[model samples]
Target: MEVYLIRHTQVAVDKSICYGQSDVPLAETFARDALALEQKLKQQINDLHSAKILSSPALRCKQLAEYLGQEIEYHPDLLELNFGQWEMQAWKDLPPEEVNPWMEDFVHLRPPGGENFVELQARTARVFDALPQLEQSPVVIIAHAGVIRSMICKAIGLPLSNAFQIEIDYGSVSKLVCRWGLWNVKFLNL
Candidate 1:
């Protein structure tokens, strides 16, 4: 099975604000980026109709998915890291030590009111399990940076703490092919 992953375009929220799972508006200049990304995907996928497109339920992701000119299957499981109470707060505004706990032990450290990568990975596992049933179908999953990172770690058997190692930028594409119970990472953070 072939899976194509891409992150959503930039949101209007300032960089100081944490926006995981937050429904923030996209940047006003998204048309250019969206068009470029769509063209890039078209180049990658000779027959765009051959790939099934899916996206996170977040507004940013939903809007970007529409640029593909197909009905995207919006899945709640595709949402970004649920930052809980830290959704819109700046790092400096958060408690001193708690802010970086996730960097140390991401799997167990839960954000004030949100979940850690552990929870994110668990949900991703469910999505991964279901993908096998759709073997031979190339699927395009437009999600968040964090979700894509988690999926990469899960695919490569990297420790959860290493999720930060993968760099998935907005509108970037990555490809994965799973065959015979083995995962082949064709592209990452493209």
Candidate 2:
């Protein structure tokens, strides 16, 4: 089975805003970005309609998935890391007492009322574990950068703390192939 992980297009929020699991608007260049991504995928997939589409329930991902295919499965587990009290707040404005510790060990530290990277990996893994069961060749998953990084970690046995090393940009696509119960990465951030 082949998996194509796609991050949503650029958002309209400020760069400093901590937005995770928040329904933010896409940038004004959404149409252009989405069209370019679609054309890129077409080179690999003969028919987008034949693939199994899965996406985060967030509006940004939903819109991209809808533009790709009509039959999409929205999963909450595909959401980005929850920021809790930090949601929609400027990262620089966050209390250093709270943000400093998390910055040191984001994998285990929970942000006030939200979960950590470990939690996000666990949930996304549950959904990823079922991908091989689907009767599809190329499985397209539209989600956030964090979710994409989590999947990469799960695929390669990489530690969650090092997930940031894998740069998944907005509207980027990464490919992975699962064979004999083992995952192999083909390319990333394409």
Q: Per-residue CA lDDT of candidate 2, range 1-190, in tens?
A: 9999999999999999999999999999999999999988898788989999999999999999999998999999999999999999999999999999998999999999999999999999999999989888899999999999999999999999999999999999899999999999999988
- Give the Cα lDDT of each candidate: 0.84, 0.95
Query: Could you tell me every candidate's TM-score relative to the true structure?
Result: 0.94, 0.98
User: Stretches of candidate 2 above 4 Å error?
Assistant: none
TM-score of 2: 0.98
Q: Under the 3 Å rule for N, CA and C atoms, how many clashes does model 2 have? A: 0
Best prediction by TM-score = 2
Candidate 2 clashing pairs? none
Per-residue lDDT for 100-180 in model 1, tens only?
Answer: 766677678988889988899898777876877874478898899888988888887998887787888878999988889
Model 1 CA deviation exceeding 4 Å by range: none
Native-referenced Cα lDDT, model 1: 0.84
